[model samples]
Target: MGEPLATKHDVFQAIADPTRRKLLKLLAEEEMPVTVISGHFPMSRTAVSKHLRILSEAGLVRERRVGRENRFRLDPQPLQEIKQWYAYFERFWENKMAALQYLVESDEPVKPEQ
Candidate 1:
Protein backbone atom coordinates (compact mmCIF):
# COMPACT_ATOMS: atom_id res chain seq x y z
CA MET A 1 0.00 0.00 0.00
CA GLY A 2 1.00 3.63 -0.49
CA GLU A 3 2.49 5.55 2.43
CA PRO A 4 -0.28 8.14 2.82
CA LEU A 5 -3.06 5.56 2.59
CA ALA A 6 -1.34 3.32 5.11
CA THR A 7 -0.87 6.23 7.50
CA LYS A 8 -4.55 7.17 7.23
CA HIS A 9 -5.60 3.62 8.05
CA ASP A 10 -3.27 3.61 11.03
CA VAL A 11 -4.71 6.80 12.46
CA PHE A 12 -8.29 5.60 12.04
CA GLN A 13 -7.52 2.29 13.69
CA ALA A 14 -5.65 3.94 16.53
CA ILE A 15 -8.53 6.28 17.40
CA ALA A 16 -11.35 3.75 17.05
CA ASP A 17 -11.26 2.45 20.62
CA PRO A 18 -11.75 4.40 23.85
CA THR A 19 -9.56 1.94 25.70
CA ARG A 20 -6.77 2.40 23.24
CA ARG A 21 -7.13 6.16 23.48
CA LYS A 22 -6.78 5.94 27.25
CA LEU A 23 -3.74 3.75 26.83
CA LEU A 24 -2.25 6.29 24.44
CA LYS A 25 -2.80 9.04 27.02
CA LEU A 26 -1.05 6.96 29.64
CA LEU A 27 1.85 6.23 27.35
CA ALA A 28 2.05 9.90 26.45
CA GLU A 29 2.93 10.57 30.07
CA GLU A 30 5.76 7.99 30.04
CA GLU A 31 6.56 4.44 29.00
CA MET A 32 5.26 1.89 31.45
CA PRO A 33 5.10 -1.86 31.84
CA VAL A 34 1.92 -3.77 31.05
CA THR A 35 1.34 -4.57 34.71
CA VAL A 36 1.59 -0.96 35.73
CA ILE A 37 -0.81 0.15 33.02
CA SER A 38 -3.28 -2.61 33.82
CA GLY A 39 -3.43 -1.43 37.41
CA HIS A 40 -5.22 1.72 36.28
CA PHE A 41 -8.06 -0.14 34.55
CA PRO A 42 -10.47 -2.85 35.66
CA MET A 43 -9.96 -5.01 32.59
CA SER A 44 -7.93 -8.17 32.53
CA ARG A 45 -4.27 -8.02 31.62
CA THR A 46 -4.93 -10.02 28.48
CA ALA A 47 -7.50 -7.48 27.32
CA VAL A 48 -5.04 -4.66 27.93
CA SER A 49 -2.46 -6.61 25.96
CA LYS A 50 -4.88 -6.94 23.07
CA HIS A 51 -5.46 -3.19 23.08
CA LEU A 52 -1.72 -2.67 23.10
CA ARG A 53 -1.32 -5.09 20.20
CA ILE A 54 -3.85 -3.23 18.09
CA LEU A 55 -2.17 0.07 18.96
CA SER A 56 1.21 -1.39 18.06
CA GLU A 57 -0.10 -2.61 14.70
CA ALA A 58 -1.55 0.84 14.06
CA GLY A 59 1.92 2.37 14.69
CA LEU A 60 0.60 4.43 17.62
CA VAL A 61 2.62 2.62 20.24
CA ARG A 62 5.88 0.70 20.47
CA GLU A 63 6.72 -2.06 22.90
CA ARG A 64 9.99 -3.41 24.18
CA ARG A 65 10.76 -6.48 26.20
CA VAL A 66 12.43 -5.49 29.42
CA GLY A 67 13.42 -8.64 31.28
CA ARG A 68 10.10 -10.35 32.10
CA GLU A 69 7.90 -7.36 31.37
CA ASN A 70 6.79 -5.56 28.24
CA ARG A 71 7.12 -1.79 28.21
CA PHE A 72 4.91 0.36 25.96
CA ARG A 73 5.56 3.91 24.77
CA LEU A 74 3.62 6.35 22.63
CA ASP A 75 4.72 6.78 19.00
CA PRO A 76 3.31 10.26 18.39
CA GLN A 77 4.70 10.88 14.89
CA PRO A 78 1.72 9.16 13.29
CA LEU A 79 -0.54 11.61 15.14
CA GLN A 80 1.31 14.52 13.52
CA GLU A 81 -0.12 13.49 10.16
CA ILE A 82 -3.60 13.50 11.68
CA LYS A 83 -2.96 16.94 13.15
CA GLN A 84 -1.79 18.28 9.78
CA TRP A 85 -5.00 17.02 8.17
CA TYR A 86 -7.13 18.77 10.81
CA ALA A 87 -5.23 22.06 10.33
CA TYR A 88 -6.73 22.48 6.86
CA PHE A 89 -10.24 22.37 8.29
CA GLU A 90 -9.21 24.65 11.13
CA ARG A 91 -8.10 27.29 8.64
CA PHE A 92 -11.33 26.88 6.71
CA TRP A 93 -13.36 27.49 9.88
CA GLU A 94 -11.26 30.53 10.74
CA ASN A 95 -11.91 32.07 7.34
CA LYS A 96 -15.63 31.35 7.64
CA MET A 97 -15.72 33.01 11.08
CA ALA A 98 -13.95 36.10 9.72
CA ALA A 99 -16.50 36.40 6.91
CA LEU A 100 -19.37 36.01 9.35
CA GLN A 101 -17.97 38.72 11.61
CA TYR A 102 -17.55 41.12 8.68
CA LEU A 103 -21.09 40.45 7.46
CA VAL A 104 -22.64 41.01 10.91
CA GLU A 105 -20.70 44.22 11.52
CA SER A 106 -21.43 45.62 8.05
CA ASP A 107 -25.15 44.82 8.30
CA GLU A 108 -25.68 46.57 11.66
CA PRO A 109 -26.85 50.20 11.50
CA VAL A 110 -26.11 52.67 14.27
CA LYS A 111 -29.12 53.40 16.46
CA PRO A 112 -30.08 57.13 16.68
CA GLU A 113 -32.85 56.66 19.34
CA GLN A 114 -32.20 58.50 22.63
Candidate 2:
Protein backbone atom coordinates (compact mmCIF):
# COMPACT_ATOMS: atom_id res chain seq x y z
CA MET A 1 0.00 0.00 0.00
CA GLY A 2 2.76 2.37 0.96
CA GLU A 3 6.08 3.03 -0.74
CA PRO A 4 9.17 1.15 0.33
CA LEU A 5 11.15 2.62 3.18
CA ALA A 6 14.25 4.56 2.22
CA THR A 7 17.60 3.34 3.48
CA LYS A 8 20.22 5.60 5.05
CA HIS A 9 22.53 4.59 2.23
CA ASP A 10 21.06 2.96 -0.85
CA VAL A 11 23.24 0.81 -3.08
CA PHE A 12 23.10 3.48 -5.79
CA GLN A 13 24.32 6.20 -3.46
CA ALA A 14 26.90 3.96 -1.80
CA ILE A 15 28.47 3.04 -5.13
CA ALA A 16 28.13 6.49 -6.67
CA ASP A 17 31.62 7.53 -5.58
CA PRO A 18 34.65 6.18 -7.50
CA THR A 19 36.41 5.66 -4.17
CA ARG A 20 33.58 3.55 -2.83
CA ARG A 21 33.44 1.49 -6.01
CA LYS A 22 37.14 0.77 -5.70
CA LEU A 23 36.62 -0.13 -2.08
CA LEU A 24 33.99 -2.67 -3.07
CA LYS A 25 36.33 -4.19 -5.65
CA LEU A 26 39.11 -4.42 -3.14
CA LEU A 27 36.90 -5.97 -0.51
CA ALA A 28 35.59 -8.46 -3.06
CA GLU A 29 38.94 -10.21 -3.02
CA GLU A 30 38.96 -10.73 0.76
CA GLU A 31 38.15 -9.17 4.08
CA MET A 32 40.75 -6.65 5.20
CA PRO A 33 41.22 -4.28 8.10
CA VAL A 34 41.14 -0.49 7.65
CA THR A 35 44.94 -0.40 7.74
CA VAL A 36 45.22 -2.84 4.83
CA ILE A 37 42.42 -1.20 2.88
CA SER A 38 43.88 2.25 3.40
CA GLY A 39 47.18 1.06 1.90
CA HIS A 40 45.52 0.66 -1.51
CA PHE A 41 44.31 4.24 -1.78
CA PRO A 42 46.16 7.53 -1.43
CA MET A 43 43.52 8.83 0.98
CA SER A 44 43.58 8.66 4.74
CA ARG A 45 42.30 5.68 6.70
CA THR A 46 39.42 7.82 8.01
CA ALA A 47 38.35 8.55 4.45
CA VAL A 48 38.48 4.87 3.57
CA SER A 49 36.55 4.07 6.71
CA LYS A 50 33.90 6.62 5.77
CA HIS A 51 33.45 4.95 2.41
CA LEU A 52 33.26 1.56 4.09
CA ARG A 53 30.59 2.85 6.43
CA ILE A 54 28.50 3.96 3.47
CA LEU A 55 28.88 0.58 1.80
CA SER A 56 28.02 -1.16 5.04
CA GLU A 57 24.91 0.99 5.43
CA ALA A 58 23.88 -0.02 1.93
CA GLY A 59 24.29 -3.70 2.80
CA LEU A 60 26.96 -3.93 0.11
CA VAL A 61 29.73 -4.67 2.57
CA ARG A 62 30.02 -6.53 5.83
CA GLU A 63 32.17 -5.48 8.75
CA ARG A 64 33.45 -7.77 11.45
CA ARG A 65 35.79 -7.38 14.35
CA VAL A 66 38.97 -9.41 14.33
CA GLY A 67 40.86 -8.73 17.55
CA ARG A 68 41.00 -4.94 17.84
CA GLU A 69 40.72 -4.48 14.08
CA ASN A 70 37.55 -3.92 12.07
CA ARG A 71 37.68 -5.99 8.92
CA PHE A 72 35.48 -5.32 5.91
CA ARG A 73 34.34 -7.67 3.14
CA LEU A 74 32.08 -7.47 0.12
CA ASP A 75 28.48 -8.54 0.47
CA PRO A 76 27.29 -8.72 -3.11
CA GLN A 77 23.66 -9.40 -2.32
CA PRO A 78 22.80 -5.71 -2.47
CA LEU A 79 24.18 -5.50 -5.99
CA GLN A 80 21.19 -7.46 -7.18
CA GLU A 81 19.21 -4.22 -6.97
CA ILE A 82 21.63 -2.54 -9.36
CA LYS A 83 21.63 -5.56 -11.67
CA GLN A 84 17.87 -5.61 -11.88
CA TRP A 85 17.70 -1.89 -12.56
CA TYR A 86 20.22 -2.13 -15.37
CA ALA A 87 18.61 -5.26 -16.84
CA TYR A 88 15.62 -3.18 -17.97
CA PHE A 89 17.92 -0.88 -19.92
CA GLU A 90 19.78 -3.90 -21.33
CA ARG A 91 16.54 -5.13 -22.87
CA PHE A 92 15.91 -1.69 -24.33
CA TRP A 93 19.39 -1.59 -25.89
CA GLU A 94 19.02 -5.14 -27.16
CA ASN A 95 15.83 -4.19 -28.95
CA LYS A 96 17.51 -1.12 -30.47
CA MET A 97 20.50 -3.22 -31.61
CA ALA A 98 18.19 -5.84 -33.11
CA ALA A 99 16.33 -3.14 -35.00
CA LEU A 100 19.59 -1.68 -36.30
CA GLN A 101 20.73 -5.13 -37.37
CA TYR A 102 17.49 -5.64 -39.29
CA LEU A 103 17.84 -2.24 -40.96
CA VAL A 104 21.45 -3.00 -41.92
CA GLU A 105 20.48 -6.36 -43.36
CA SER A 106 17.56 -4.86 -45.29
CA ASP A 107 17.68 -2.53 -48.29
CA GLU A 108 17.09 0.53 -46.12
CA PRO A 109 20.15 2.57 -45.13
CA VAL A 110 20.74 4.46 -41.93
CA LYS A 111 21.22 8.09 -42.78
CA PRO A 112 23.97 10.05 -41.03
CA GLU A 113 22.78 12.35 -38.22
CA GLN A 114 23.33 16.05 -38.80
Candidate 3:
Protein backbone atom coordinates (compact mmCIF):
# COMPACT_ATOMS: atom_id res chain seq x y z
CA MET A 1 0.00 0.00 0.00
CA GLY A 2 1.27 3.43 -0.88
CA GLU A 3 0.77 6.60 1.12
CA PRO A 4 -2.09 8.90 0.16
CA LEU A 5 -1.38 11.55 -2.42
CA ALA A 6 -0.30 14.83 -0.87
CA THR A 7 -2.67 17.70 -1.66
CA LYS A 8 -2.34 21.25 -0.38
CA HIS A 9 -6.11 21.64 -0.17
CA ASP A 10 -7.33 19.64 2.80
CA VAL A 11 -10.57 20.19 4.77
CA PHE A 12 -8.77 22.35 7.34
CA GLN A 13 -7.11 24.46 4.70
CA ALA A 14 -10.33 24.72 2.72
CA ILE A 15 -12.34 26.12 5.65
CA ALA A 16 -9.53 28.23 7.07
CA ASP A 17 -10.84 31.38 5.41
CA PRO A 18 -13.93 33.22 6.68
CA THR A 19 -15.16 33.80 3.15
CA ARG A 20 -14.99 30.10 2.32
CA ARG A 21 -16.92 29.24 5.46
CA LYS A 22 -19.64 31.71 4.52
CA LEU A 23 -19.76 30.18 1.07
CA LEU A 24 -20.33 26.77 2.65
CA LYS A 25 -23.20 28.14 4.76
CA LEU A 26 -24.78 29.75 1.72
CA LEU A 27 -24.65 26.51 -0.21
CA ALA A 28 -25.77 24.41 2.74
CA GLU A 29 -29.45 25.10 2.13
CA GLU A 30 -29.39 24.95 -1.65
CA GLU A 31 -27.12 24.81 -4.64
CA MET A 32 -26.55 28.10 -6.42
CA PRO A 33 -24.69 29.53 -9.37
CA VAL A 34 -21.23 31.01 -8.84
CA THR A 35 -22.56 34.47 -9.63
CA VAL A 36 -25.23 34.15 -6.92
CA ILE A 37 -22.76 32.78 -4.41
CA SER A 38 -20.37 35.61 -5.15
CA GLY A 39 -23.05 38.14 -4.21
CA HIS A 40 -22.98 37.13 -0.56
CA PHE A 41 -19.37 38.15 -0.11
CA PRO A 42 -17.80 41.59 -0.39
CA MET A 43 -14.97 40.24 -2.58
CA SER A 44 -14.97 40.03 -6.34
CA ARG A 45 -16.49 37.07 -8.18
CA THR A 46 -13.01 35.95 -9.23
CA ALA A 47 -11.94 35.89 -5.59
CA VAL A 48 -15.03 33.88 -4.71
CA SER A 49 -14.15 31.52 -7.54
CA LYS A 50 -10.74 30.98 -6.01
CA HIS A 51 -12.34 30.05 -2.67
CA LEU A 52 -14.67 27.69 -4.46
CA ARG A 53 -11.72 26.03 -6.13
CA ILE A 54 -10.11 25.34 -2.79
CA LEU A 55 -13.38 23.98 -1.41
CA SER A 56 -13.83 21.70 -4.41
CA GLU A 57 -10.26 20.43 -4.09
CA ALA A 58 -10.83 19.67 -0.39
CA GLY A 59 -13.95 17.59 -1.14
CA LEU A 60 -16.04 19.96 0.98
CA VAL A 61 -18.01 21.35 -1.94
CA ARG A 62 -19.20 19.93 -5.25
CA GLU A 63 -19.62 21.87 -8.45
CA ARG A 64 -21.79 20.93 -11.37
CA ARG A 65 -22.10 22.72 -14.68
CA VAL A 66 -25.62 23.54 -15.73
CA GLY A 67 -25.25 24.67 -19.30
CA ARG A 68 -22.98 27.70 -19.15
CA GLU A 69 -23.43 28.22 -15.43
CA ASN A 70 -21.56 26.45 -12.63
CA ARG A 71 -23.61 25.45 -9.60
CA PHE A 72 -22.02 24.84 -6.22
CA ARG A 73 -23.34 22.84 -3.28
CA LEU A 74 -22.10 21.60 0.05
CA ASP A 75 -20.93 17.97 0.11
CA PRO A 76 -20.64 17.84 3.98
CA GLN A 77 -19.09 14.34 4.02
CA PRO A 78 -15.58 15.71 4.51
CA LEU A 79 -16.82 17.74 7.48
CA GLN A 80 -17.56 14.52 9.34
CA GLU A 81 -13.84 13.91 9.60
CA ILE A 82 -13.42 17.36 11.12
CA LYS A 83 -16.30 16.77 13.55
CA GLN A 84 -14.84 13.41 14.56
CA TRP A 85 -11.42 15.00 15.10
CA TYR A 86 -12.88 17.64 17.42
CA ALA A 87 -15.20 15.15 19.16
CA TYR A 88 -12.13 13.60 20.79
CA PHE A 89 -11.53 16.88 22.64
CA GLU A 90 -15.19 17.37 23.59
CA ARG A 91 -14.88 14.93 26.48
CA PHE A 92 -12.12 17.00 28.08
CA TRP A 93 -14.24 20.12 27.93
CA GLU A 94 -17.25 18.24 29.21
CA ASN A 95 -15.28 17.00 32.19
CA LYS A 96 -14.09 20.48 33.01
CA MET A 97 -17.62 21.86 32.73
CA ALA A 98 -18.95 19.13 35.01
CA ALA A 99 -16.29 19.90 37.60
CA LEU A 100 -17.15 23.59 37.45
CA GLN A 101 -20.82 22.79 37.91
CA TYR A 102 -20.03 20.67 40.96
CA LEU A 103 -17.99 23.48 42.51
CA VAL A 104 -20.79 25.96 41.90
CA GLU A 105 -23.42 23.58 43.29
CA SER A 106 -21.47 22.42 46.32
CA ASP A 107 -23.45 21.24 49.38
CA GLU A 108 -21.95 24.08 51.44
CA PRO A 109 -24.35 26.93 51.07
CA VAL A 110 -23.00 30.36 50.24
CA LYS A 111 -22.79 32.75 53.24
CA PRO A 112 -25.11 35.75 53.18
CA GLU A 113 -23.36 38.85 51.86
CA GLN A 114 -22.28 41.18 54.74
**Model 3 per-residue lDDT tens digits across residues 29-108:** 99999999998888899999999988888888888999999999988877876899899998886786575543344577
Residues 13-108, model 2: lDDT tens digits: 888999999999999999999999999999999988898888888888888998999999988887888999999998976787676543444567
Using alpha carbons, what is the TM-score of model 1? 0.75
TM-scores for every predicted model: 0.75, 0.81, 0.77
Candidates sorted on lDDT, descending: 2, 3, 1
Provide the lDDT at 74 for model 2.
88
Worst 10 residues of 2 by lDDT: 1-10
Candidate 2 versus the native: TM-score?
Answer: 0.81
Model 3: residues with Cα > 4 Å off, grouped in runs: 1-8, 100-114
Each prediction's number of clashing residue pairs: 0, 0, 0
Spell out the clash pairs found in candidate 3.
none
Model 2 misplaced stretches (Cα beyond 4 Å): 1-6, 102-114
Best by TM-score: 2
Candidate 3 CA-lDDT value: 0.83
Off by over 4 Å in 1: 1-9, 102-114
